[model samples]
Target: MPTPNPAALEFLLTRRSRPWRTLCLPAPDRDALHPLLTAAARTPDHGKLEPWRFIVLERPALDAMAQMVADRGGVTGVEPEKLSKSQAEYATSPLAVVVVAAPKPSEKIPQMEQHYSAGAVCLALLNAALAAGWGANWLSGWPSRDPEITAWLGLSETESIAGIIHIGTESAIPPDRPRPDLGKLTTWFTP
Candidate 1:
């Protein structure tokens, strides 16, 4: 017989990401965020590579990133509308954690698996924040993917942004979006 934690199961079933735009002030301070980061660090890593790191961005850093997006957008020929949206993503958020996928060289484990591990960390952080009573959203836009922007953020040549998780107080409860139908997506195999 297996023991089941009903509360944990319920939380998994009902978890929903709040929109970054809907998040307000009173974001978790460093002391409060420590546990969430610790929880995120517990993500499964194949071969014990630990190929990921986190960068917490406060208002000033975010503002600088916002300016960088605005300035670099013109050089990169990004459309105005897309540039504005990306800029707002950095400018408005009270606090965000950038999950960087820094893959380590491994003869046994592939780079793709390392990347997946970093992405898992992002989800873990997001879920942890939500479970801790904070509104959270995972975001990655053109700025996060752009080499120039990433370099400014101190990403090495081997590192890339897995996600930027924005965390803050919930201003509104967003209507739940449609979820995937497991029956249509799942396939049971029998021999």
Candidate 2:
């Protein structure tokens, strides 16, 4: 029989992501964040391709990214409200890690599998931060898909942002929202 870990299971059931706007200062330093990154690196990868990399964005980098969003929005004719929302994501974040999906050329592993691995990495990073007692939220907006923003962040043609995980101290724990009805979503298949 496999040993059961109730605590870990309970945590998985109750884990909730804090709101990005509510995250405060005193974000994890490099020394503190290293372990989270290490944990994130342990995500499942088919063919061991490791098709993801993290870009840590501190306050200064966030500031620059905010400006880039604004500039890109203006040039691309994006709506002002939408632009402001995207800009605020970077401008107000205390700390953020961009998970870049960098697919490798491989005949054995499909590109879609590599993309899935990158997405798993993003979730792993978010979970690691939350488990380490940090408030964390995953976000991806229009800016993440923008070509100009991708270039600015140094992502190559074969790479894109899987997620932007913002981390910091939690000011308040928001109420849990409604969860999916498992019975409605699940289907039993008997052959």
Candidate 3:
């Protein structure tokens, strides 16, 4: 008989993403990170096109990304406050993964479907990190959507970042945020 996984389901139903700003030291290492990536890859793929990829942001990579943001601020007229926040997004990140939605050129595989797959991978990665007992949050600031920033991240025109997931141990557990009413949103058809 297949083993029932009630606990996993329960976790999914109530899982809440920790804020990136609340994360601190002791992020996942290579051995620890491999399994989480494997879990994320198990997300549903309509045609198995694997229309996404991950870029692990360790210390060195994080510094490089932060510098790029600074360079961008100079050219794009970003104000100091916003620029500081952009810098914090990378500077304070002990561990992060950039989820890129790389749409393949195929008439059969609609671009929307590829987009959906990419989004699924993002959630899967977030959930996997939480399940592994880590604090993780998905973030994408102006930089993520900026064309200039995309070029810096080495993404082709057809590629987009689903999210940038910041992960680490929790420095503080914030209060639970309110959720939308499921009953109000759902419709039952009992014909």
Candidate 4:
């Protein structure tokens, strides 16, 4: 018989993402992040296609990204008023992981499957953070889609940034927002 983990299940049911703005310092160190990466690797991938890769944004990389974002923001037509605020997100975050979707073309595996795998990895990483007692959020900023920015992050031609998972201590607990009504959304198949 498979061992059931009720605690994990219950936690998943009640879990909430700590708002990115409310996340602060005390992020995971290299030794501490291994398990989280391992958990994220367990995400569902059709055809065994490992369609995602992670760019662990340590201090230096984060700083570079922050500056690059600010510069790129200027070129991308981001309003002058919001540019600094946008760059500050990277500079201030304790830790950030860029989930890149590298969709290798395959005759057997469809592109959609690769995209799905990438998305699953993001959720898995988020869950790992929550389970690890850290506040986390999955985000994809404007810089994610920029070719020049992606090149700096070492993405192949086919790869794109799927999400930027930020993990840190919670500065404030956000109120529970309303959720979509599942009863009204789901279709009954009993008939």
lDDT digits (tens) for residues 6-35 of candidate 4: 999999988999987888888999988999
Worst 10 residues of 4 by lDDT: 80-89
Candidate 1 has a TM-score of 0.98
For model 3, how does the per-residue alpha-carbon lDDT over 1-191 read when each residue is reduced to its tens digit? 99989999899888989987898889999999999999999999988899999989999999998988888987898999999899888988889999999988888989999999999999999999999999999998888988988887789989999999999998887888899999999999898
Task: Sort all candidates by TM-score, best to worst.
Answer: 2, 1, 4, 3
Q: After superposition, which runs of candidate 2 have C-alpha atoms over 4 Å from their true positions? A: none
After superposition, the stretches of candidate 3 with alpha carbons farther than 4 Å from their true spots are 1-4, 189-191
Show where candidate 1 strays beyond 4 Å: none
In candidate 2, how many Å is residue 118 off? 0.6
Give per-model TM-scores: 0.98, 0.98, 0.93, 0.93
**Residue by residue across 115-187, what tens digits does model 1's lDDT show?**
9999999999999999999999999988888999899999999999999999999999999899999999999
Question: What is the Cα-based TM-score of model 2?
Answer: 0.98
Instruction: State each model's CA lDDT, in order.
Output: 0.95, 0.95, 0.91, 0.90
Q: Which is the better candidate, 2 or 3, if ranked by lDDT? A: 2
Q: How close is candidate 3 to the true structure, as a TM-score?
A: 0.93
